[model samples]
Target chain A: MTGGYGLLVADLIGVAVFAASGASAGVAKRFDLFGVAFVGFAAALGGGIARDLVIGAVPPLAFADWRYAVTAVLASVAVFWLHPKLHRVRRTVLVLDAAGLGLFTATGTLKALDAGVPPVGACLLGMLTAIGGGLTRDLLTGEIPIVLQRDIYAVVALGGAILVTIGHRLGLTGLGPLVTAAVLMTGLRLLALYRRWSAPVAVP
Target chain B: MTGGYGLLVADLIGVAVFAASGASAGVAKRFDLFGVAFVGFAAALGGGIARDLVIGAVPPLAFADWRYAVTAVLASVAVFWLHPKLHRVRRTVLVLDAAGLGLFTATGTLKALDAGVPPVGACLLGMLTAIGGGLTRDLLTGEIPIVLQRDIYAVVALGGAILVTIGHRLGLTGLGPLVTAAVLMTGLRLLALYRRWSAPVAVP
Candidate 1:
């Protein structure tokens, strides 16, 4: 029960943080309230939706569970009101974004395992779940995807996903494994952020 | 057998045309060959993939059906070799794009119906199948979606989807109704293109 509760809390926090990032992007683009909400929802839920669809889990849990949608909306509203202040704390946002990334990667891998996806596929789905929402958000705002451009973002997510998927395949499906993966993922992301590590851009 | 062959032909043509447009976008952006291929595949098959996932069709047909993947790659290669000349025939590309829109919308709606989706959901799926690829393509290329910016693009697809969905709901699933819907959709898209119709943008 505690494990399930912890997972739920982590998932909700991830959703809220991702939604805020998306809403910030919408606000930066001067989108209207509806537009902000749309961006936020896409960012919070798009990755999971994509992962679920690939695994044939219909009506994606995001749609089946109203709390996810509500969380995204509330986050968007909060950002809409506090965007200027939020912008000033960009470092904090980045930290939270990394935390969300770790949470999502772990959760996504777990869901894919539950759906009986192969380890490799589950790992990919986990990474997708971590990066997909941000991709959607940036794309909608006419910006290059951050995952494609900077930091150890997707790479870290991919590592976490792979770790979790392997753990699951090895019959290590519990809070301990999940927490370890999430912590490792979050730590790597933050370290990369502070250390200014980036994926190499292809020379044109 | 004949009906199945014809549907296959139509689907391939749509994929090729959409792939061409995506490859053209990649070429315009001076992307690498891999990037061009990526954009082409996304543009050609992303929509159907999205639609299939929403309806619980796991492991999307594009992944399961090698032919679809092959067609997209061939189209991408063709574009890479012929983009300069192809770019000169902008008008022809527009016409082909409209045709693709109509074909995908019809086929997508039919697939949704076959999957037992309700009429309304089927119609939405059809429209999504038509627009989703182009949306992904444009967004990835850092442009506002053409469907949202100019022409009666998505609107026409939605109209065609509604017509086909309604026809199916009313037991009018014959080729005659489907063909008529496709023709009307293609025609409306062309008309909108030539007439410079635009979706209303909200004033900031």
Candidate 2:
């Protein structure tokens, strides 16, 4: 498509996955429906909204369109209804979350670069966007954020963002480069999960 | 002085009060020294930092000005050294917190307007700046944010922000109006606390 629709599809899918993860996490933490909805909204749009606000995009995503709200609501409902039955599918959920993280990381890098942020800053925004939701969710539940201590979580996103930044500067083929970055992030994340890899828990 | 420097000095005093509240809250919550410092930092700068990032101001206060970091650290250290001795001063601490809340509420309102935000949004942002840190602190510690489930938390800041907005619009002179707004908020909050007022708990 010669339009923004293609990217919008990816963004929506990413939103759904992020919301689902948040809702499921909320359920596990024994939060009420409102709390679940808050987590879902934070997970899905927190990063994008933060990025947009930073770039001075007025009336951010929370107010921009109804779709974002709809996605969060739907995700919350889905988790509220299905989480009990899906408890065994933690692996599947993790895979879906990894895909969403990859998608959001790409979106962050692209949006920041589009707004004229420098390469390093763009990458930083990308990683922040990918991890911000999870961080908020964890913090709200009185747990250490996974990003601050996890299996190649932020590092994978940072690596992908760096590649996206470099690719944009080098005038690389868009789809080819995007796929490379996304696959790298997703693959690394999944492998880390499967291998039970984790960062050292030393206090710095 | 026509220059805002005079206003800035008053605001710094409020910031110091805010730092003390943050440090004490951390101590009351059983946080270690590092946690106390983090809480103090969050309490002192969380609001302004959020405002700056949302407005796309680069390198937030914690990084740009050494004073913010110094203020948080000093407050944390002071609390660490004095908490045991100051145990009898719980009432005084609450009074100081009220005072800090007033100062922060006023400064938050001014800062949001100075950034050229619309009246309603600016007012909301101002309130957020005043109470955002405490909210984050409570949530991170697995308690309901005082703002969400307490009497007159958001409402006070809202009033302060609106008063300041209207005062500026009417070309009101001096710090009188801002002070009035803060006093209103702080007084109301203290009343709420003294009366043991609370929001009804949500039934799951």
Candidate 3:
């Protein structure tokens, strides 16, 4: 189980990264400030909300927790003001995106398991939690989902979620297991991004 | 206060219309079959799922009832195979879309009221239930949501939902009230479409 403070901190960081990513897309699209914030909020919180709703966690944690919403808003504002500087740091963006994916995958899987979801379902939910936010951002911007179009993104999320689910099932539910799972996921994502690894497409 | 069989029939028709709408968009975008089916399913069912989750209903009714899914799939396949002929019947699509908005608004409001949501919240959720599916479909297809950009669409939904909520509060939760609310909403939508009425936009 993740310590409460540790999980909160990780979640906030993930929200910031996801929000910043969404804000960048909004800026690129020349959306107004309200549109930018809307996309940013959706990207930061949509995944967690989707997972919670599926698991019958009403009002989703993000809705209940002011801090998560504030973090996303802060990220959105920062991106709006400093996007030029943020855009220059390509590597940082990549790393943060990867880290967010890992963190959400771990957290989502654990939450589902705690809610009595079976392992397979928990793993799928975990993957959804990791990818759903970015999917929302891309969709709001009227783009084909990056996860579906290319790269080894969803596979990395699935791999991380599977590991976390298995570890929890094996009585390895400590912070150590969570950290290990997240790190593995993040590393794989970064490697895939760097190597230009892509998922196989159907022969259409 | 809805009769179960009557509500079910209305829901099935709404689902068919929403799915057909989503599939036409997918066909226009030249998405693959999976993409077409995905949008169709989301457009048919996403709104009800959103409403149910907000009211703490687990496993939204659409998920529990296989018929809704089947209706969406049938509509998607129909659009896939017969889009050319279907597209020729533009007026039919418009009428179905209006009918769907009206039906979902009434049903959503009634359901929320039954769940004990406050009148205003119930009204909002009802509107969400009417528009969330198309919002999702538009976002998935990479378009600014029609509800957001166009003529008085969501406003009409909100009006219908409000009427239902107020009627229920006034102890007028009968078939007559429901039908009246729905007809008014549908008529407004159709009038707006025909009259070229548009929502106010910011002067940029």
Candidate 4:
């Protein structure tokens, strides 16, 4: 299942978009080039690395596959230079980020299940894979994680993870369920964003 | 080496001290009980889990062994309830934390070396194991990581790790070098703390 070309492409897209967002955040913070690249890499691959580690996929794909690192670094460098022009299309970046979040959730869940994690654990791992990168990125910049402080971001990923887990339980295979889950999550995230949907904060 | 009763005890002590520090931070931030516990666990075990994952130690000792989790959580709870009392002994806590930092660096390097990691990578893994928890703890509370922002904390860990790696290369075996490295690191950390020594920040 993981060997599929389509899934690989989707994963790379997710890495690139997430890297761009991370790089943009670094730029906003006025980090040096090295710091920006580090943040970009962390935001792009941190989640996948965490998921793989939890599932005992040692050395992690991020270390073994140069493509993931190259793609993330390239996207980050592009954002470093073109952020002024990119800012004009903030909506596009947001939409792409939503798509990346969804893709990560679907693929992460599938990978966890493939590695024999139980259904509940797989769902959690899936959510972690989706949100972990952004969390790291925010934390590095000394901002409260968006997933913890606001928005329906992680919830949407959780929803997609649940869907993938259910599909796996029902003997559903191949990319069909995974793609569906990703699409559904992306749509939900966009809806939530446009609607200003957010989880309630704890009362003071 | 891992099976040594001495190493096991040292590891638990490290976990407890780190957990206490994390819980204290959470309490200072006015986080609720659950958040305190979560922070404690992250601070105590996050590094070990990360090290285990990188080296392919599946399930991580923190998960596989109930004692590690129990020790961390108990320390966190204790800190939550007795922080006022603990405050009277802040110096003691600082000393213990230094010990923990040293122990983790030594054990982490040894484990990485045992796992066949090269000396340079082992040194890095050792430093990560020592500092990863505090970094996570600070990040969770929306603070820039101290390792990146100040002091000689991570550098001391790296020093201990390099010492252990050198010992390994010199055909020194058993607990002698590990203990020496841990002791040296702890002393260095304490001296640095009292002397207000810190690494210089990059100039703007």
Candidate 5:
């Protein structure tokens, strides 16, 4: 395990970015402070909690770490104090949000593989972990889950996880495949946004 | 079992009334038609589902009975189509909602005893089944769960469940205990409403 300052920084960034993103979603839904905090909590920790559950880690993530709560509070604060200013920069938020998504996807994939899940399930779990929070937030707030919509959403996570899995199998765990996974997903996502690469809507 | 037209009417009334309450909540929250329907579904069957899960009933109430979903959807239609008119008499809606609560609570207690849950668990499950929907709805919307706050709340549910449990043990399945449970819970709830009863807020 990469137990060092680098892992800490990566985790911290993921926490902060997801928190901010979640808070913004709650506010957009016109939820009160408690709602905002819940969304923030879901966004920052939802992925990891889900990953833990799937890996048979008992009692989930929040119970294991108090820091998750502290970060959730910070997210609520950002929503209450700086949302108007933050919302103005769509590009910056998207990148930070995508970065967090990338990190979580990688971490989840690594954990699942380490736990002896097959390649398919591990990749699936990785994608689910990366997006579960937003899905839950939308559903709880009475909106359709966005991941099920036409975006390069699950595909991006799957691609990244596959890349990492291949790299790990080949013992190429240096920064190469790690950066490759993150970069490919974030770039594909950003490009999908700019180019409006959406799937054709199905007529009900 | 009260196998007759009267009990059937009571059951149907319970379903429709709870659905109306949920649809009204949806309108208050400004949810879309689908959102309102989902909330109605929750109100109609959330408690039963929670009870089933606790007792290890796989797939739970909605899966076992398609009528539950139909009732929720039909009720949502009424709320959506006639919301402007229905919103006029807030008192009527409240009365109907309370009646639904009493009926569901009574039925839940009976079901728990039938399932062979001990008195303590049976009573707890009854209260859980009675208010589980509203509690879940409030939690998702970031509001304090109603059961955790005002009115008779969990008290009446616990009381009614206790009566039923005791009666079942004494082999007294007459109309007396069932009717008494319903009246006691309903009366206490309305009285609390009139008296403006609330839990005391703790000063930080």
Candidate 6:
């Protein structure tokens, strides 16, 4: 597949995983079906929408493309009905979430760069795209964002984005650098989880 | 002043008030100066950014205009330094918040209508504009949104937006209907607060 097509596929998978996570959160909160769907869609699209808006991309692709909405809603409905079974595979979900984070960071950075954003701004936008969905989900569920509370989540995304931005600046084209950066990001995030590594809370 | 210029001035005033409210919340949470300023800017611009994105307005005015940023920052700094004295006049802040809500709703609805949105969609956008900032503030502070919890806040904004949309459809142009709608909305919100009125919670 072409590089662009590969990125699109990765983005859709990321959306599905994020939607499932959001729907799970909604179910845990005892939200009704509509609420679950709303949360799921927000989690899937919020990051992309924010990125698009900041870059002056009108009518965010998530809103314009029917496929995104359909995918998110399907994921949400599946979680709503099959959560008990899904809950048994908590480890799988965590792994998929790491993958999603990596995919979004990579793609978001590339998009921002394509829009002529400077490297540093692109890196921040990439991190925002990785975390914004989960932030919106947590906010909708009335909880402090886990990103702000635990782990090196956002930092990991930023690290991946930096790699991508540097690769692009070095004339590394196509899926080679993108895939490498994504895999590295996912692996590092998993390692962080396994090692119980976390960012510091506050200064003494 | 022309209607558009008047709207711009009203929007700047709304930004200042919303920034102050957000800064006050940050102070209550004991956030540092930077955090308070960040929250202030977010509250001032979040609603307009959301509205601009939804309507396909590239480069949201809040981000493009230096005046908006300067106004919000000034308001935040003022509040950060003068909060103790400002707190003595709690009623004034409440009244200003109502006026901000009304002004945003009116202007948001008009902007949506100008963008060719249908009446219902415009009204919803207007309500979103009125409440989105406060919702962001509450989320950042780790609290449930007041609009969703208690009070007729969103509903009041929607009412004013509906009136503005109706007026526009009737070919009532200029600042006349917009000002009237805003005044009516502010009055109703104040009355609702005084009378302890609130939207219903979930059904029993």
iRMS (Å) per candidate: 5.1, 5.8, 5.2, 5.1, 10.1, 5.7
Per prediction, fnat is 0.23, 0.09, 0.23, 0.24, 0.00, 0.17
Give per-model TM-scores. Answer: 0.63, 0.62, 0.62, 0.62, 0.55, 0.60
Lowest summed lDDT over 10 consecutive residues: which window, candidate 6 chain B? B30-39
Clashing residue pairs for model 2: none
Candidate 5 scores a C-alpha RMSD against the true structure in Å of 10.0
Best by TM-score: 1
**Candidate number 4, chain A TM-score:** 0.97
- lDDT by residue (tens digit), candidate 1, A75-97: 99999998878758888778888
Give candidate 4's TM-score. Answer: 0.62
Instruction: Kindly report which residue stretches of model 2 are placed more than 4 angstroms away from their true locations once superposed.
Output: A1-99, A112-125, A147-204, B1-10, B25-42, B56-82, B85-87, B117-124, B135-177, B195-203
Model 1 pairs in collision: none
DockQ of each candidate, alpha-carbon based: 0.16, 0.10, 0.15, 0.16, 0.04, 0.13
Among incorrect, acceptable, medium and high, the docking class of model 2 is incorrect
Stretches of candidate 1 off by over 4 Å are: A1-3, A32-34, A56-58, B1-41, B62-135, B144-204
Q: Give one digit per residue, the lDDT tens place, for model 3 in B15-123.
A: 9999999888877777655557657878998899899888977656664556887799789877877887875798988998999999899989998999999999999
Give the alpha carbon lDDT tens digit for every residue of A26-122 in model 5: 6776555555665677677777777776776533444344455577657666665667777578788888777877877887787788888988888
CA RMSD of each candidate after superposition: 6.5, 6.6, 6.5, 6.4, 10.0, 6.7
Q: Which is the leading candidate under lDDT?
A: 4
lDDT tens digits, residues B19-100, model 6? 9998888777765555566578779888987898888775566645668877887898788788878868899989989999
lDDT of 3: 0.85
The CA lDDT at B147 in model 1 is 72
> Mind giving the per-residue lDDT tens digits that candidate 1 earns over B50-142?
998878777676755667777997898788777767658888888888888998898899889989898889999999999999898888788
2 or 5, which is superior by DockQ?
A: 2
True-vs-predicted CA distance for residue A190, candidate 1, Å: 2.2
lDDT tens per residue, model 4, B93-151: 89999999999999899999999999999999999999999998988987778789888
